[model samples]
Target: MPRQDDAGSESEHGKIPKSTFEIYRAEGDSQFRNKSFLKAIECYTQALEIKPGDQYCLVNRSKCYLNEGNIAKALADAEESLKEDAAFHKGIFQKAEVLYFKGDFENALVFYHRGHKLRPEMEEFRLGIQKAEEAINNSVGDPSVIKLRSDGDLSFFYAAEEKKKPAARSSYQKPKKEDSGPKRAQRNKAPADSKTIKKMLGDLYADREYLEKLLREESAKARKTEHSEKIQDLCIEGLNYLDSRSEFWQQQKPLYSRKKSAMREAAEKDKSSAAKYVIATLEEIDNKQTAGEHEAAIKQATRLLRTVEKWSPEDLQNREEIRANLHSLIGNSQFELERYDQALASHQADQKIGEEHELEESQARSRDNIGRVLAKQGNFSEAIQVWEQRLESSKSLSPMESTWLHHEISRCYLELKEFNKAKELAEKALSYANQMGDNQWLLNTNVLVAQCEVRLKNYASAAGNFDSALEHARIVDNALAIDAINRAIQDVNQKLVEEEKRLEEERQAGEQGEGDAKPDEAAGGEEQQQQQQQQQEQQEPVQQQQQE
Candidate 1:
């Protein structure tokens, strides 16, 4: 210390003014508290230059980087801090925060638990563990609930309070020597302790056994509701404990298969009870569908189908009927979910079963479903053919059913741009709807007619039809239909205005053209006469020259 100063100037090879590491670190802490992340980073960098292995400074700067949305830099700082001190709780927590923000809740939970174990009193670590667990639960139970990265709400995982800094020293402190011996010794230990590993394995086995017992109980139950509930609970528990990497979890695979087989065997042993169970399961699927749980409905229908497939030939008292019902249920659920390809496949399977059994009603229903799918896919020509075939096959139908079929065919024709055909079918459907006095079909048929009229460029007729449709929609108290008809009316009015403007512009252009053409025709006649006189004069000159 050639000249000691208040700012802690040091001289080794040359004298220079330099603040102590504590002062720079304190400045960083102040900036960080004020939310000045860039300035905090600058101060932390200066502190690190003075004391390169300061874990506290590195961890604090990692937090600053995280606040600035620099995830990679934050992770780098956290990793370096952990390298300096492997037991650094703040560094571990920061690493977990980065993982949580990245939507790796499983790994985040691991790191958070590790940090919590090291620092039990830290509220941030505990909160992080809780959040990571919640995220993991959502991902396991319903993946759709997980927020996307672009959802702009990563602050939920970052809601922990900022950590307080340690008390600063009054004087400059020398950098401590690196400790490699202890770190190297610790590195030789196993990643997880033997006791913890054994506990994890034991817990996994216990859960698996419990699930297997539940499945057995479920198969023994005669009540379908109780049995379905038990199976559903087993599925949830299995999902909660499932881990692909664990040997214990992998061992549970055959147990799950055996449980499924047992359930199937029990159902097949009693055909009457099994039929009742199938009906109950179908009712459950329908309830799910009605509740807008389309995904759950689809899963239940698939499971029922699998169970039906496992039934013995003799045990299948109503095998064809049950299979057809399951297929139809799956198709309806998939359709509600807008999974068109899967729905189409299920409907086709149902149709084949119906055809083999010669069930006319089922066949007609399948054809209708197929036509609906085709129309949704914009294959209107094929949809029309299918609907026409259905129409031809059904000779004796209720007035409402026939009206609905005509309406369906008219919709196809409208999509295909066949306005004349659409109008004819729509009018016929309207007549049937009027005879039945059904307001809903009347509204639909009226809209179809309005659409056809718009396509035919009959704006007044289209407007009248839309008005009638709107009145019917209002009478039925269907706000959505009312809005649709209102929009149609507005569109027709817009088209009418455009047409009138176009006609007026054409009339003006024609009048201007006529006025301009009269003068042009007179000038053309005068020019023609002048050209003839000039030609005669030239010919007379030639004749005189010849006579001479």
Candidate 2:
């Protein structure tokens, strides 16, 4: 989770010195290597503070941001670096990559040409050119169109402890030729078997090559003879095959294009055919459940339940895309019917299926949905915990996904009576929603912000957020958002009016008490004066009686 302190920007007091570029770099690279991207962002931010256009850090750091699923930061850094040096191949390539990732394919293609022109003979740069060209041909060429959680940390995707097979039980023994010995893909990395290896030597070297090719510059420093030999070998072995066949490559393009076209057509047919029958059933159940006949919905759900139960992994993967939709329908129906156990049970069963799957993306989504169900039951803390875990595991979460996380976090903060944190997270969620252009999420975040204000005793602000929520609700055409906002607005207005009336009544009571006290003091003074007058009158009466 990003620290609450990162709410705005760096603090003025504890400012990192402007000269500490090395420290900033250390922190940035450490976090980048560890895949702790939010920290890396902070580090890069500090570095940029010291030196605005640190080209090396800016370019490398921007790529890290992209890997961290921060498209805006990546775009900003890439654009800024490119501005510094328009023909700088590294920065230009980074810009093109960011553009491609952001779905700016036409502009990305144009930049790709510019980048390629700067380093036409470079292999990696040519690959970027190839990627752009392919995007134009595919009509779906946005390379930057990353799905949420698409990037798996190398450590996560490739497990560290390989489970030994039964045949390979002997410890300290090398593998036999029959097993082909783990693909040998991480090999061919030795630098002539002479130089002591740096920890990130391979990956660093690769990145530097990528940088030089895209930057249209020579290597940063002259390499060791051994290193030169290795690079030369790679140049020969990697792109040399393409070079060897370059003469005839254009002739093969037509055949390749025909095969690709046929494959795409077949894929579309397969995709269309793979939808589940459960979708229609889910709709029918939803209507039935709405009509207060939840048993009918449950019966409808059972149609797919048994089929899903009997499905193999392949079947589930290919044909059970509607499982979530159908399950949600049934769960809603059961809840409306006052069958809490059944509703919870249905959701739990679906959660189990998600747990059974090994796909991290699917698993994160499952956890998020489970947290939603828990939230409906007012288990806000538990829901936040579930999503916090999911968010932590989720690599490369986009802005929309982050909105979901922050919105959920705000709800949990509300339940915990952390009103300030709740409001902050709600506001953060709104910002992310705007970034994602997801109106529904924006509406939800606005409504939550209103509720947070209510918790903070800020009635006027609550009313304002409620109005904002209603506006967004109208834009999104969300009945629930509209209803919730209207209710909150009315509630807040009534509360404010009542509070005003109560304060007026209290003021009037206080005035009446003061008036009563003054009269009491006057009455005491008058009684004493009257007593003195009576005494004097008695004395005078006695004197007059005496005179008479």
Candidate 3:
């Protein structure tokens, strides 16, 4: 709900409050267009509660439910919507489709026939009738004999046997006994159907005419499976999409048609003709991958990984890029898995090539890799020292102080009992980090400073710092920082108790010594008084100054 501050400048609907018909209608429309079906549900549910007869809300809500495969809710919605507006064609269509999907073909056929009678030229409705008839026809087959093979042998016995067999979940393991080997071997295995049939990656282009055609077909199907409508159509609509700078939906299409056309036009005489074309296409794809372009990188990485696998490690050449990207994928996957050592190694492999080949970004990345691995191992001193050198040597922080450098180094110092240094550095990091508008990362620096204060045993100072850190971390909902603070609170409390105990012990010892003093000094008092009077005369001005 939007609130108005006693000003007419606010919209009439502003003060209508949340869950109102107008609010839900607006939000539902926006979220539906944005393809957020779950969010649209929230909005539609709101509108339906407020205005039960909102035609637009019900119809759209039905669409969201259908998309989410909630067939029951979709059926209820379609029926309820038709009750609201009997003449609505979309609702009628939805009702028929829901009935069909639910296998109530008898009622479905009746609804489809009625819909078709009203709108006869609709091919989709006609298809629905055909599907209903086909289901009715197929219903006569025996359940046990339904899956007879091409040779007319019953498959249920074999299929049931396979189902009972245990699958090998580990990628590296062999399947359990009952078996024929897999038709599509698990990842890390050779292609299950045929060793020659390698996977076509999303963007990888096959230059050979036949190979390109097959790869494009598979890629198109894959894109469709992934629900990427635009990219899927690219295989057939290559030229149309490739010509338009904005039509990136089918960018992978160019790899098939364009490369094949070029290879076909150049010479169809030899495999080398296609190989040369493939090399050219690969180079273009590699450039996009290296530039941090993600959509194409996924495609490029799979292709590159397979290409490297085809060649013996020693025989591979000039595909420094292929190796680099494979390593990048390995490193990223390992990083996600928290296999820091393996991740660092893979990152270094790529980073090493980029550096040896004079790539500055690669060198910076290598340094970042070293920092990640070292910090994970709790070698904060070296990691901090390394990043400080990098920060000093560079004219300006690369890409917003590379937040990890500042944050990781600070964490190290806090761990190593170097509180002042950590707090000072973390604060400095926040100054530069905020200017770059990386607000969350900047907030992280504040949290690090708070952590340092806690480590320094400055409890009075730390409480306020921790409060601010908690507020910011809550806004970001940063899990790591929240966990750190919970631990910090416990840690600081223990340290405070220990310090107070030590101070009280020392104070008690001083009092005990004073209480044990002897009174035998009375005899010597006369001599002592004469000496003390002389000392007092000498120290009187100093004592006065001390009193003042």
Stretches of model 3 off by over 4 angstroms after superposition: 1-323, 338-341, 392-395, 436-439, 477-525, 529-548
**Across residues 125-226, which tens digit of lDDT does each residue of candidate 3 receive?**
665665554443222211132122222221111111101212213222357797666442111211111101212222322322344365356665633553
Q: Candidate 3, after superposition: displacement of residue 307 in Å?
A: 3.0
Better of 1 and 3 by lDDT: 1
lDDT of 2: 0.57
> Once superposed on the true structure, which residue ranges of model 2 sit more than 4 Å away at CA?
1-294, 311-329, 336-338, 360-362, 437-443, 458-548
How big is the RMSD of model 1?
A: 25.2
Per-residue accuracy of model 1 over 114-181 as CA lDDT, tens digit each: 88889899766766676555444322111221111221110011122234334332122344576332
Quantify how close model 2 is to the true structure by its C-alpha RMSD in Å.
26.5
Alpha carbon deviation, residue 234, candidate 1 (Å) = 41
**Which residue pairs show collisions in model 3?**
none
What lDDT score goes with residue 299 in model 2?
Answer: 84
What are the C-alpha RMSDs, in order, of all predicted structures? 25.2, 26.5, 27.4
TM-score of 1: 0.43
TM-score of each: 0.43, 0.35, 0.38
Local accuracy of candidate 2 as per-residue lDDT tens digits, 294-350: 566678877866676676645544333345435655665565454656776766655
Give candidate 1 regions above 4 Å deviation: 1-271, 309-318, 504-548
